[model samples]
Target: MRTLSGDLIAHRLSQAPAGALSKRLYDVLQTAIQQGAIATGSRLPASRDLAQELCVSRNTVLAAYEQLQSEGYLQTRTGSGTYVCEQLPETAPQASLSPSTSSAPFNHIRLSRRGTRVLARSGAGAYQWGAFMPGVPDVSHMPHDIWRKIQLRLSRRMPVEALSYSNHGGCLQLQQALAEYLRVSRSLNCAPEQILITAGTHQALDLVAKMLCDPGEGAWIEEPGYWGFRNVLAVNGVELLPTPVDDEGMLLPDLASFSQLQRPPVLICVTPSHQYPLGSVMSLQRRQQLLALAKSAGSWVIEDDYDGEFRFGESPVPALQGLSADAPVIYLGTFSKTLYPGLRLSYMVMPKPLAARMKMAHSELYRGGNGLAQLTLAEFIREGHYAAHVRRMRQLYSRRRAALVKVISDSLGPAFLSQQGNAGLHLILSLPERIDDVALAAELEQKGVLTRPLSAYYIQGTQRRGLLLGYACVEEQNMAETFAPVLHCLQRRLSPA
Candidate 1:
């Protein structure tokens, strides 16, 4: 066995004579580390030094080192030398000498729970009305045939590189298409380099959470807001402050001046175009104020434009990121709401400087979503299918929303208060006083009408009792029939007679 420079010795493969010993060395080192022979925190030799000691080519040493790294046996710290990862398990013998275990009561390390996350219960697979669904598009009438043709054509003409991870920033064609689409449609003033394609809004949120907010820094969230946003912030260990939201979205004046507060938020997340749960779009006047405040405070404003593509009436409001002069805002838009949520395609528009860092983080995070899907979507957006599709769905959803509104008015009466946010898939039907929304929803579920309660979206005091009803998926003809029973259930629960 040839001893390597620092601490490694080659484990001899007596049976096999090998010319390229790097592959064998890599496997041996990996097995040693995994089996705990080479303990965690142990350092390996420099590639050049190890090569000389082992009497092998520098390439062989380099190859072996890289293989160990890719397999997670060793981790490279920026500027610091490669060390055996703390992620690597230690041998039982090493544990015997540990002061904590040897001197104190013995207990096994729970790898399943410790150093790992237990995913919080999400509303996945559960059919609940009005929960902030991560990915559900008004796919009631998307032109699948057209999309399929585009995908087929793209696949045929696509370079072999398209089959592999093309670029960390995402597909170039898609980025170009998105940039052009945003400029005219969204009024976003940015180029393709500013966009970092991501796997839906969840990944976008997670990336922003990782990038801007340090642990314990405040990330101001809306009270009674979309739970997923709060969940992302919460799991990241951000100090969350729930600001109140009322008739207008995000109650700008209520944003507790971070300067006045000791722990000022480094980041602020808001669904400005259309507030989730309550479904109130932040007014144009307040949009300016939010930008001014975020600029003044020098905090990054994360505008999650989830359902911004759908505006059934009036001129489309300008994106807050577009309106803002300070380049601190990170704009997030996803096809989950605009197209099919199952597509799992979304993008983040970054300020120039942040884009470079975001790209570095992205490659480390996920080399980007599937290259094939990105290619398909690129053609969809490039050929004008995306915009045309949204226009059709917007009209379709408008009819369903109107139908839901009518059914609520007639069956539940005008006495039950409601939120008046137009241009989203769902709306909140505020209930009368003294009715338990959660309990009522359960009763409604048994009647085969699944509706969401506003109480569940709340994390603070003074939560309103109501149901969140999504109209996008329901057919305009069936909207009345589908909502009739739900409305009756809410009415019967609140009746005084």
Candidate 2:
């Protein structure tokens, strides 16, 4: 009848890895019981005696004893003090692991079919900030002080509901604020109830894919389009139709072509305002044609109004959603490009008919919370700060774009500039067909010049060789110096061997 005495426990406790006193004591006693150091049904020293002997508090020993007893390592026998349980928590003693066995390489984990598809596609870059990182904004210019004040005000009157898991579309204040802003700014015809706030464009697209599309359905996306749209649909096992785009935007396929397909496309995603990478505004004729085609095909059109707020020349085009009263268009927009990416705030304005169902599905799939941020943004917009900020950023980006374009033209040539749109943060720098844009982009990155290869955006059709230079983040004063490395690299790549 071996007893777990204070001396033995103290030694084991010392041997136990550094941790809280109660935890160390508990681990030591548990190990002793498991290893049969103390025989089954053996008695333990009283808490007071053990505490005094080990120079610890009686409460610490009591806590360890209580935990051990709870875990079936020790049992309390009322007036009989503490005893080891005859039956251990584990079925049997853990086998000692050999050094080789412990150090062996872990077995490979096989991913699902969907997981494999997602892994095959990569859109995210290693670095998010710095010169020429496309689709990223100048976060330094963001009104942090104003945002902080708004957040602080909301915190003082924070409601219990703000902390709870929200299911309803989103913060009502934000939805209303966005509704008003969109109606006036973008000519979007949507009520506050039609909007569903999401955690960035990824979540918004994911939710749309899940709610509207199924495993085998067809989704038509613009060639040289946003890689994110392709990834989202790919994960859902949706068949992607990489429709080509011209100067006008996504070329709407003829009605006859739709009927010829084994699976007609149920959805079409387009960046009509300013086509991604290429930066071509979809023509008014093309926009009308697209809406008509969608109507005839009974397809949903997702209008991603990315960077629509930063047009340099002409007034911004009205969103595709407002083309018709009952247009089958889902308008998508985000504050990431407008404000800062960290906010993780984006919105989807659903067609009136789909609004209720989509909101219900959103709540079921992704519980919303971020009430404070949403509320602050609402106040920001309501107070006209949002508009003022956009106006300021537009002017700033315009200057930066002009400086970058001039540098490229002076260093390379005017012919290198491709589809330099009046809007958006980025412009395309077309390269010679022989130059591998991917390899060139890699070299440019090493030289501290970050640019996305235009060829990488194409899913199908003839690959165009170019680089998407995001000039919005770069300061106008530093544009010439910052682009020197890129120009040198391009000259080296383009020069004869």
Candidate 3:
């Protein structure tokens, strides 16, 4: 039996802080065993000897040993000293199981082409909430108290059916509430049966991509549009055709031009309410034209109305789906901006003909949960709290947007120009043609400012140089202070050294 020297244990224990002697001793010994400094099956010094060497009471050493034994780090033998466990608990450090020289063969694993593309364009930053972090709403102001009360009420009053797996679309209450709300607010014509609840817009897009288009079919996405839309379509093996966006919105290719191609787009996605990054509302004329084109081409339109609720203009524009009676448009909306992102509740108003299949596919692809939350949100909208909250946030976001615009004009001067459109929570600051927006964005991030480079949104052709700055989560009072770092970074970069 090999015995561990009291001197070696004392040396290891000496490095630990002066805490409860037993706990400190236990931690030190545990780490030693985990690191393989103490070999398995080696007998440890007797409690009295270790206690004397470490200058701790024998009772403390005994307590430490007892803890180690209970935790499976040490094994006690009848009429024998405590020994390091031969078979440590499953929670034992993996490093202790093998020689340090061995390496994992991670390079041998192969990812699909689709997976590789998805990873290549993952521009999501580590930090999502801060000054000028685009697309995030002011979740700090969400009505948590009211939401919690509703959640509790639903939990208690809900029937047993609410707790089980929901094989259908979603909670009927939410669908009905959403149907009524959409009719009045967004002019969306939909029955309760047509609404399908999803985790968020990404899942909605994924389902639509799967159902409407086959693999290798062409899908038209707005150039300089939402990256989430691009990635989701790419991962599903759909060929993405980047259609350019002008002041009016997506500039659709002529039908003759599409006919020339071997595979024309069967799916067309647009943020007609407020075009992402460069907030341009699709003109009424263009909306009709696009609808007519889609109807003729046998194409399905996906209208992402994300953040349309908080439009800061005269009046919110009606959704594209409401423009015609049987328009082939899937209207997508989410509570992430109005309420909170963590809620992860979004819905799509599907056409009656395609509704059943999409719902079944959604259920089969991703099973639904969070029934209580859906029920609570249904009550929230039914009781008019959702509308009330939207009104309040609209005023708050408008004020913050104005403050940020003024700060940018004052700080950046003619060097940067704010782009068009007064709707949506973010503003685009167009940079000088020569300046690299990506590098500037990186510098700004290091100084505690978050902004998305406009160039990153473009997939083809000449990319615009600008920054998308979100002001919804930023307060009017702190706007100047929050923008100071960005101004400093810009000044430092543009200054003649």
**Number of the predicted model whose TM-score against the real structure is largest:** 3
- By TM-score: ranked, best first: 3, 2, 1
lDDT of 1 at 451: 69
In candidate 3, which residue pairs clash?
A: none
Per candidate, the number of residue pairs that clash is: 0, 0, 0
lDDT of 3 by residue, 1-497 (tens): 22356776777666666777787778778877876788899889988888877788999999989988998988888899889999888775442222222456458878988889999998778999877999999999998898888888888888766787776688889999999999999999899999999999999999988887788998899998899999999898899999888889999756676556666578999999899978988999899989888887788999999988877757889999999989999999999888888899999998999989888898899998788888999999999999999999999999998898888888777446655677788888887777788999999988889999999999995478888899988999999999888777777767777
Q: Rate the local accuracy (lDDT) of all candidates.
A: 0.74, 0.86, 0.86
Cα-based TM-score, every candidate: 0.73, 0.81, 0.82
Give the per-residue lDDT digits (tens) of candidate 2, residues 1-497: 22346667777676666678887787677766676777788888888888888889999999999987776788887789888888787664453332433466888889998898787887888899989898889999999999899999989998887778777789988999999999999999999999999999989989889988888898888898898999988898788988888899988767677556666678999999999868888998888888888887788999999788988877778888898988999999999998999999999999878988998888898898899998999999999999999999999999999998889888888999966787898888999999899998998888888999988998774478998889988998999988888888888888889
- Candidate 1, residues 93-156, lDDT tens digits: the string is 2211212213566577564431243244244436632322223555657788988888888777
Name the lDDT value of residue 30 in candidate 2: 71
Error of 2 at 387 (Å): 0.7
The lDDT-based order of candidates, best leading, equals 2, 3, 1
| Model 2 stretches with alpha carbons more than 4 Å out | 1-105, 256-262
